[model samples]
Target: MKFLLPIFAALLLSLTTVNARAAEHGTAEEAIALINKTAAYLIDEGPERTFFEVSNPRGRFTYRDLYVVIYDLQGRIMAHGMTPRLVGLNAMEYRDDDDKQFVREMIERAAKGQTGPVDYKWVHPQTQRLHAKSAYFRQVGLYVITAGIYK
Candidate 1:
């Protein structure tokens, strides 16, 4: 019976470890997928009227209410759904010393026309949550759409 108890405890510990790993990886993976889907939409629709339908139902610049950012190859902010202060701003220079440096690096890579997944930790701008961000970049003309989430 003592051996059985030890065996059960070992099994429980292993399962907990495995589940924790899976949860961590799964959240980032899912956030990446969502970001990619939005990026694809930005590529197909472009910035001008892409949010027209959404804004009609919601209001002007409703997309800004969502956590999204679109930038040109020069790292200029093309469209952002989060911050009104970001519009027309040069994204390469926007910095928050308190946040992680991940987004800046991601923007630099995207400006060079690279498209892929970039993951990092940050203090979220909107939610104030400390989060892991998985951003996927998609190029459309001279612009790059980056969509991400806090996990």
Candidate 2:
């Protein structure tokens, strides 16, 4: 009984810790760092393999609401961490309810231009509700890598 109590308590503590960290996982600074790191990883590993990883919902690149998405300079979706259906689509025409051309703005901000934050509204992967978001991205050689955090 003594050992059981200790074990159960340890397990509960670990679970609590994990969930708390996940709840606070994605942030602006983390997004920017992750985007740059993912860009380098994609370059080193090649797109065929990296894209598969990025598209996997449970993969390393998909952490809670924060996932890495890559778009080619021409506005085509290359890899999406959560929405596999978005792949190969020209997301340039996608707009928010307010007619804000977010993807287009992201391309402009991230494609051979500068590394900065882009604001938009998007559907939450878990909540299924729309939320205001800010994404930080960087342009690598062939693609622009992005990671976002919802507010």
Best candidate (score: lDDT): 2
TM-score for candidate 2: 0.81
- Superposition error at 11 for model 2 (Å): 24
Residue 103's lDDT in candidate 2? 78
| Count of steric clashes across candidates, in order | 1, 0
Q: Residue 52, candidate 1: how far off, in angstroms?
A: 6.2
lDDT of 1 by residue, 62-81 (tens): 33213556676667776665
Q: Estimate each model's TM-score.
A: 0.54, 0.81
Name the runs in model 1 displaced over 4 angstroms: 1-46, 51-66, 95-104, 111-114
Evaluate all candidate structures by whole-model CA lDDT and list the values in order.
0.58, 0.83
lDDT of 2 by residue, 1-151 (tens): 8879989999999999878856774888778777877887888999888888888878888766789888988889999988888899998888987799887888887655877687888887876779888888888877888889988
lDDT: worst 10-residue window of model 1:
57-66
